[model samples]
Target: MKPVITVREYARLTTDKITEPTLDLAQVSVSAFDWLCKLNATFSNAGAALVQLENRCLLKLDNYVGVLETPCGTRLEILPKHFEREDCIKQSRVLLRRMIQVSLDLPTREVGAADLQNFDAPLSEWVMGRFLLALDHLIKRGLRFDYQRVEEEQRFLRGQLDGVKQMRQPPGRQHHFQIRHDIYLPDRPENRLLKFALDEVCKATKDAGNWRLAHELRRVLLEVPRSRNVQQDFNQWSSERLMAHYVPVKPWCELIIKQKIPLAVAGEWHGMSLLFPMEKLFERYVAASLDKDLLQDARLKTQAHTEYLCQHKGKNFFQLRPDLMVLHQNKSWVLDTKWKRLNSSGEDKSYGLKQSDFYQLFAYGHKYLAGEGELVLVYPRRSAFDAPLQVFEFAPELKLWVLPFDMERGVLLGAPEGFPLHSQQLQSSEQSA
Candidate 1:
């Protein structure tokens, strides 16, 4: 049986030959391992492995499960656990789907029962499955292939020959006349890249012993031309062209173009492992959720950039980009999401809230919220810090709220649970507005 180990970011694990042994990664997974190493993961000299998941990557691995396949056909499953098992997995799925939509710039779709059925499946399988479904849909609508002009020399005339060029080259001594003709072809860079990605996913599915998914991917790959030198040629296409022609596959294509995921190559194993910064994800989730649930007439802006923190020699520097800014009735509320776990025992010490964070929010409070409005620091609700602590007295006018954003509930708890100031101030601000 394959060994399953649970870990989190910066978690270290020593290989025990007796109980759990070190993995001899398969070529494909080795390539995936290389990708991880490029990120924050490290392998020790003592056959131990350490995965230091940064905010971005942890966000990317929504399910927080990584499957490493070995050359010996054995598998090592690494599940990063930070919260309760079920809650963590559920949260991961939600984040993963959101990340996919954001990366693709696609609209968020409701998660159906069918999608949740595969909640326990490997993340790669789900991603590839979604990709395949999209690809298949595009194929049904007729794969977008452009009529690219090709110019080549041939002994025999193929199309309308270039008389000027033919004259310059003259007739070959062995073959006779050489002709250059412009021929329209379907084998373009965009198509090739898509084909390459499909093939890569297919191989990964096969390696995972997921024949069902592999079969579907193979069927789709059959329709696309076997792309060669895709990595070298993929960058030539512009985003505009991709959106216009390859609308269905545009997101996946962008994933490859941006190197957010891995491109498959023949003779070498390659896979994609995505990571998301928890800070950004938390901020986005809060901003989006608040916009939908909390504010009615107010405008919500994320990473709202309005002013520079300071000016030097007539030069503006240090731009103030608040995570979430809510504007209502001529008043702005600046809220920043922090992914740190608050400790109740350290209440005297700001509940493990860094002094720098407080200073940062102070700047936001003064500059963006005009000192009188609510300046909030949001954190995930933990058992220790389930409720919002007392508001910080940054100044007489400015108030700093330490609130808990309930991950499981997907809402900002109020008062003793969260920050009471949030709802109260918003209501007061709205009544005045």
Candidate 2:
């Protein structure tokens, strides 16, 4: 059996300790450590700083969380650092899946049934199961077909005759006619890409159920050929309004086909890195939640780049993109999410808030909100920082709110009095508008 170890974000794996694994620490053999070092090296070479190697034998995980499998069948599961409650691993795993689903714009109901049924499976297994579920959905909706042009020799010509090829036939093959024709078939680029993804997932999945499902789907797509060149197929893939159901499955297929680590180094380690940066995951999750929870009249925009921090001689430089921008009537609010946990202890009077963060938010307030509206720094709601802190005033008209977002409730907490939220203020604004 594979050695499955679970840890939280910012956890460490050490080769010096051979003791039992804990939530934040684990012991791996030298060989496993070498595999990790290779993995880190590959990530660095690909311009991604996902993990850091300490000393020589310690492998430290940064903010990237998910599953990392080694070539030797050692699996490292990293969960969110703040999920410290009972059964936190399971909770974090489910939450991570939801975040990925939201980020990919997949409906929660479509790919979550199998996930909920297999709660204790590894992250990789869950991912494979999700892909299989998506394939199943696509199969039920009916596989799409496209016209494939073919040139062949037959007893009778069906399409335009290939006179040049027919004239070159041997003496005994005078009856055979060379024809070029287009046939409506299921061997298009999209189905080929899906078939390739299914093949990759079949090899990577560890669950028997996933294997069986993949096999069934492969049988269903028997007419579709596996992609000979994935990149070429991707270039040829096109979206059609009629095949709208393909939207949710395409991302999963691409995710399965491409290694997340970003480098294709030649080595014995061919395992997949199904990791996601916590910052991006948190930002996208918060944006999606806010969009769903906000009133219809109020619109939320993500990563809006309508402003710049400064202007140069001939061009505008330092473009500012706030994570979440809420527009209600004539009012605009700029909210940026931080995946870092806040320190609520008295020893840290600043609540561990970075000075640079305030500067960033101040810049955003001046540019995005016209320097007079409310600016928010949203952090995950943990036990230490379950409520909003006191508001900071940059000026008489400019105020910055450091608020906590309740992950469980999917709501931002402790907005100041008279804030434009679900209260009468928002209602009145909508009414007035």
Candidate 3:
């Protein structure tokens, strides 16, 4: 197995092992490099958003963060941009797992950063371990048994005989009965799908613990055949009250079985890519945190589609969807989350804030808040950009608050007037400094 390479999103990749942040492509085997070249070629052809090949020997990762493996067992762990510092790689993984848990609403309990200090594995193996844990819990709780419909030709007639098949049988084969019967068994679609996930984990996991757990679970699920058609089995699955324990494990199954990621090059590369767009993940994590930590007696709406930019040909065009909208006491506040970092002391006084974002948020403010309410732009809290920037006032009644969402603490830090913020979440932005 090749040594696992860790890089933050947007890090440079070169052929020679030169420096700290830039991934030395030389560490990968020739086959793995060829596979990466093929992936880059495919992504270039399809206009994929995963990585960009700057030169023949260089690659630039886009705004995606996850674990991807090459066919030659070259594992690459792409972390969030906020984990730029060298000492924070483990911290990054922990927080990334937490973000995934919250955003995807995986039924796993809170896993603190300290809890995973010893388990230094990539996201893929960590996720596989979580799945195995859930599966083990489920097995201890007892697997669900259902009366599954089975069809077979047997010496003994059981349940209802297939009349057409029975008649179609040869005359000398009277002893064999073509029967369709309902048998109570644990080999149902859900279990079969889980078996399929277990097989995938066994094949793909690089961690020793995950591999061992996967093999153990595989033995337990030996009677349950692997899923032939995952989609078909999922279609057949039902969220009946009995399989509540399976809920936590189901997401892991889908994530592994489907290799849930936006990049399409995984199929051609014949490798595992469990990537998520940083912007989307950040947006969802912030929204979920707000809904959980605060927002009591209030409603938090995501992707609010209550307005459109303009009308053409008597039809609405460019529908405006703010990342989040908080409704409280018959009043509304609009908020948007940006995954980009900000700088306070730069040649540009805007603190790396994009003008286009302001324009977009300006439109959202006018449309969603009628140009009279507070708007917020949430960015991930980092070392350089720990404090919130001063508010931007578009008019006497309208203002914009650029706040830092502390990823480690899961708190939105800023003081925005008229915004419903709990004291615990309303720490002074400078305090983080």
Candidate 4:
């Protein structure tokens, strides 16, 4: 069975085939229903499960894909938008590669067996499969396990006795001492956490009927000890060690660590979810793309915090951090990327531009660029707004350009017209003057 299905089709599938139709959850697979319930519980408002259409469930998703699994071994992948699979995979790879570089300070390796170019799979499957492949590779190369000192409270009269005499039970009962043993053990918190995550992933994959991925994950999990303490306890050194040996898995590890919860509902673990906030992903992709495509002399900064828009009594507050800032010789361009759909109507709806966004951009222009230079609002190209909107002036001197970043090409659409002229021109004009 194809794991991925559109939300509309799913809703239809769960609905009764009658004139006055009602949703019947029984129509859908048990696993899918469980997955939806879990999503509702975990994500609440932000979850993909949007509303209940009678017994049918409606999902609210766009430009995103969710991988869901139930305890009964049902795997349901939901992708709301029908994006070009190759393009989506490529963009995802770009984002993950950049994340690994930023977080681990390591270069990305060849995707190798996990390459999504030829693979026709759902987004969730691809992501999980790629992660499993990376993880398996790292494990075969040897997991970065470190010897850690362990302390145990044991009932022994021979070993190192407690320094506190009162706690020694005064020679009446069996004297137990809390002995700190420096035994080199592989069951460190980091290893345990990794093991725990691996176990969860293995279960999820198995439930999803991804036998190959599950097998690989299980093989890795065998080496690491099952940890009762699923809490995150790794320090910077431990992370460095793990990333040093397996840099490609850094992003996956971070995601697992952040999302893994020990609580089990319905006798099955609520597996870790790898959700990429589209806003941040778009921002990162745009920044990385611009860094390469922009002029060599041009400097680009992501999440640049150079100024504060407001201040309290002797303290600074309400700082402005623009998504992307490009600085040239004598001028700077302040740009912010918004991951939202634009208005389709030809009428002047400002292309569904938010008033607060304009206000924010205006502040960025006034504060960051000294109320000069070009201020740009960047958004991903959608069906409604395919091309760059006309440039408008917030003030006579400050221009706000609304441009689209094309996902398929992985480049800013109409870049030449969207970006402002280099500051070198201004310098030449000034020199000539």
lDDT of 4 by residue, 301-331 (tens): 8888979998899888899999988887787
For 1-433, candidate 3 gives per-residue lDDT tens digits of 5667888888766665554444313244556556767776766677655667787667678888888788777888888878665677878888888898888887655345465676677898888888888888889898998888999999998999999999999989988999999988888899999998888888887777888888998898888988898889988887988878778778888777764444424564445568788999999899888888654777899998979998999999999999999888978888999998787656568888999999999999899888898889999887778887888999989889999999977888764755666744445443575
Report the lDDT tens digits of candidate 2 across residue range 335-398. Answer: 9999988977566888989999999999998998778989989999988888788889999899
Q: Give me the runs in candidate 3 sitting further than 4 Å from their true place.
A: 17-30, 41-47, 110-113, 150-153, 157-180, 259-265, 424-433
* Candidate that scores best on TM-score: 3
Error of 3 at 369 (Å): 1.4
Error of 2 at 9 (Å): 0.7
TM-score: the better of candidates 3 and 4 = 3
Question: What are the TM-scores, per candidate, against the unseen true structure?
Answer: 0.68, 0.88, 0.89, 0.66
* Model 1 C-alpha lDDT per residue in residues 193-286, reported as the tens digit of each score: 7777776676655434444655665675564576677556566655674446455565665453335432111112333434444455566667
Model 4 TM-score on a 0 to 1 scale: 0.66
lDDT of candidate model 1 versus the reference: 0.56
lDDT at residue 345 of model 4 (Cα atoms): 64
**Residue clash pairs of candidate 2:** none
Candidate 1: residue 193 Cα off by (Å): 2.0
Please give the clash total of every predicted structure, in order: 12, 0, 0, 0
Query: By TM-score, how accurate is candidate 2?
Result: 0.88
